[model samples]
Structure formats: C-alpha cells, structure tokens
Target: MIPLLVCDDSAMARKQLIRALPAEWPVSITQATQGEEALAAIRQGLGRVVLLDLTMPVMDGYQVLAQLRAEGLSCKVVVVSGDVQEEAMRRVQELGALGFIKKPAPAEEVRATLQRLGLLDLEPPLAPTAPRPELALKVNFRDALREVSNVAMGRAAALLAQVLGTFVRLPIPQVNIFEVSELHMALLDAQRGQRLSAVCQGFIGDAIAGEALLLFHDLEIGAIANLLGWQPQNETETSEMLLDLASILTGACLSGIAEQIDVRFSQGHPQLLGQHSAIEQLIRLNRERWKNTLAVEISYSLEGHAVHFDLLLLFTEDSLSRLTKKIYYLMEQE
Candidate 1:
C-alpha cells in the first residue's frame, strides 16, 4: 500500500476526506493535525502523496508546500481546501499542488481528481464496504461545528474577496455555547471599545434558526470604500457602502452554512443595528433577546488592506437541540 497523509486541523474534516477517497485505492493512511507534523511525516517517507487542508494552525498547507519546494522535496500533493477562490486555486497550483478539491469533497469528485492527477488507477468498485470504525465515530461536537463553519466561511470569504479584489485572511473559527452575560463580555473584550457598526439579520428554516451579525470597524469604512475605487461624498453614500458590504457578507455567509446542512434559511431583511456605535450598547440592545446562545465567530481581514470584519452566527437557546441533531448526522454521514 502506498503511504498517504491527510493533514487537516479538524478531525472531522480529516475523516471526511478519508472516507471520500476511492474505496479500493491501495494506500496506508496517516493523519496530521497541523502542517509541521505533515512536513515531518513527508520527510520520513510517510506521505508519498498528500491530501492537505489549507487552513490550519502552527503552519498552513501553503507554507508546507513552500517548504517542500524550497528544499526540492519530491512528492505529489493535492490540495483539499474550503478556499475555492480563483486566487487560492491559482496559488496552490503555482506552489506545486497537483489539483484542488473543495470541502465536503464528494466521492465521485475525489475519484475523478485523483485519476486526472494519475494518483489513482481506473478501477471498478468491488463491493460496498465500510470505512474503518476509528474514522467513522462521531467527532466532538465543537470541532465538528467549527469545521462546518470553517468551510462555510471559506466560501463567504472567497465571494467577498472576489468582489473587493483582495485576499481574505481566514482565522480559525471560534465556537461557544455562551450565557447572555458571557456573550456580552466576549464581544466587548474582542472589540476593545472601538467604534463599530453592525448589520443584523435573522434566518430560519426547517428546525434551524439563527441571527447573523456583521460587525465593521467604524474607522475602516473609508478604506474599504477606497478599495472599490469609490469615495463616499455624503452620509447617504457612506451608509450605502456599508449596507452593500453587509448584504453581500451576511447573505453569502448564511447561505454557505445553510447549504452545508441541507437546509434553506429564509433570511429576514437586514437592518442597520448601529452606526458608529459602541459594542457595549449593541450588546445591551441584544441582551433581552438572548439567554443562552451558540455563537460561531469568524474574523476576516484583507491581505494588504486595513479592513476587518467579524461575522457572528448566533443560534438561540431554543435552537440548540435541533442544531445539535443536524450536526450529529452531518459529520457521521459525510
């Protein structure tokens, strides 16, 4: 069996890839949770062909590729990542990746990609077989949710990046089950008393329900407008710019997550929650409606621009049971 390394920060993501591989392919699989480990394994001949995730801690797949190329290491690499932006795909190809596959990679797509890369021989399925039990267990709920949100955010970031003509820096998603107090404190501390603006929109479908908040730093609005080659000459134009950004980000992000779980969220109209307002006031306004919440936070930045945005997917307390049920089957089945 050939040695294959699956490197990803999320255990759920790693297993999904493992299960998606051509069932009859001849390979002894090893796993790495971060890029440094992946590099060490590759150097030790543990990964002749690698399936690598782009977003990870300590090091990323892109860094690993650069290191390998710098040292003149020879190995076939296929990037399996959630960042499907044209820029991301182009960069990895230039960095020596054999091919690219988007997240929740389907079995058929995996087969075709591998075949095209000459990594898999054309063969027929002999029988329906189960993946190893170790790879089939239910992953930790928090990690699973973060993985889902990670993939979801990648799509959103790609879209936003395309519109703005900038590369979006994706942070590791933060997942929390927070009491109302904890939520307030968390947001306040993260904001550091900076003046901010936000767009609030609610969504629901089937048993899943949540609200998405897109928070923008007040001072960065002008910089963002400049990126689009426009200068806001009046209050209305400035507000229009902010609203347009909020709409694209909020809609694309919510749609990404909804697509992952096979649910269609009917999103309510977005409203300006506040303009040049303190986050504390925003939290106070929201406190009455939140008791316990599932908060998934993603911080996005641009590669060479002074622009940042925080997107929060806040699932209400009542939505917990149904959301958990949805996530339970999501990772297990994938």
Candidate 2:
C-alpha cells in the first residue's frame, strides 16, 4: 500500500481527513503534529503524499513547504487549513502545494480529489450515510457554534484591521466547554511565558450576560501604543493607551459576537486587572466567580506586527441553557 502523511496540530483535523479518505483505497497513513515532524517523516520516506495544516506551533506549513523546496524533496502536498483567506491560498499555491482544502472538508469532495489526482482508481461513489445516532446532536451543535464563531471572528478582525491599518491574522476561533479551573491550561498559547495585563468588561442582553476579558502581554505595550499612534511618555499614559487598546478590541469582538446571535449588549466600563501578573494568577483570583462558567477563547494575532492577545468570553452556568438554545436558533435560521 502507498504511504500517506496527515499532518495537523489538531488531532481532530487529522482524524477527519483520515475518515474522509475513500474506504476502498489502500494506503498506510502516518501522522505528524507540526511542520518539522512532517518534514522529517517525508525525508525518511514515511509518505509521498502529504495532507498538511498551515497554522501550527514550532513550525508551520509554509516553513515546511519552503524547506521541502530548498531540499528539492519530491512530494505531493495538499494543504488542509482553517485559514481560507485568499492570500493564504495564493501563498500555498506559489509554494507548490498541489491543492488547498478548507477546514470542515466534505468527505465526497475528498474522495473526488483523490480520484482526480490518480491516487485512487476511478470507481462508483458510495451512497451517503446517515450520521451515527449517538454522535449527531453533539456534532451538529459543535459544528454550528464553530461556524458562527468563524464569522464573528472575521468581523472582529476586520474591525481591528481598520483600527491598526494592517491586516489582522485570525486563527480559527476555538469553541469548547471547560470548567473555569481548566481555562488556564486551555490558554497556554496566549500566556506563553509573558506577564499579562488584562481588561474585563461585562455585557448584558436580555437573559444572556457574559464578561469579556482582553489579555495582553505587557511586552506588547510599546507595539500597541505605536500602532495606535500614541506616544506614552509616562506610566500613566502607557496605562491609558493599554486600556484604550483593550476597549477597542473587546468592544469590536463582543459587538460582532452579539450581532450574530441577534442580541444587543449593554457594555460596562473596562476594568483594569493589574499588570505584570501571571495569567494563571489572574484566573485563580476569580476562580470562584467563574468556577462553573463556560468560556470561549479567541486568540488574535496581528499580521505585520509583533502583537498577540487573547479575548475570552465567559458565560454564567445558569445562562448556558439559554445560550445553547439561542445558538441552535441561529443555526436553524442559517
């Protein structure tokens, strides 16, 4: 059997791709979590055809493609990424990727692509199958939430870009249900060994009320100030600039999310949570308040800049049932 490599930082993505492959096709599949590992596997003859994800820690797909070209490696590469931006697509094509597939790839499309590439022999397509009974409800809700979050994130990024005058790079907004204690662990990407300054703003609308926390690494202050065309000559000025930045981002993001759910939010004044504090410490201090909250984390990266921050929205436990119903209602409308 021919060997195939599926490389993605997300285990779920890799599994989805594997499942999407034609059932009748015979191949040995290998998996890698990042570009470096994927490259190493290719060099070792683990696979000739690679399905790669672009956004990964340690090494991304772009770097892998560049290195592959530099080393003159012969491999068929297909990009599978959540970043479906036009520029992202053009860059991967220029880097010699055979094709690009957006996230949440349809199984039929995957099968067709393989056949067109001569990787799978031409055969009759299989009939559609119903989703398994146990997995249907859970999968539908998660998928709907993810899709809505994607749209909202794009809106937020667009607003941020307008404010920064530079393209804002957005990763896929992650949606998950985790206890407040587990939130610190889930946010390791945002708190990667940096002292953070946070701003918390509460928003209420009908039965849905949540808090949006904007977390910025203290080291990002200068870059943010310059982006906002502010010359902070003193500590007070710096603090003001930081708060202004947080207000703009959190406002735009929360507004975008609310717009999607057909809710109007009354936002509160931004409250400064002390600077130069560990992220875990900040969360731990308020752990009791949010112990049972449902948190949605969105990490925003500014392109052409060295600024990175996270926006976290936390909903009270009692509001979850209402939130889920609203989410489902929105999904049904779509």
In angstroms, the error of model 1 at 206 is 1.9
lDDT to native, each model: 0.86, 0.74
TM-score, predicted candidate 2 vs. hidden true structure = 0.60
Off by over 4 Å in 2: 1-139, 187-189, 278-285
Q: Please provide, for model 2 over 1-334, each residue's C-alpha lDDT reduced to its tens digit, 9 standing for 90 to 100.
A: 5668889765545656677776666666788989889999999998688988887778889999999999999888888876655667788999999888876567888877776777665334445444322122223555566555555665566667777776677765677776876776766656677777878888888688877888888888889888888889987787787778777878877776677678888999987777656466657776776677777778888888888878888777767777789877865543
For residue 13, model 1's alpha carbon misses the true position, in angstroms, by: 0.8
Residue clash pairs of candidate 2: none
Per-prediction CA RMSD (Å): 2.1, 6.8
Worst 10 residues of 1 by lDDT: 121-130
The window of 10 residues in a row where model 2 has the poorest summed lDDT is 130-139
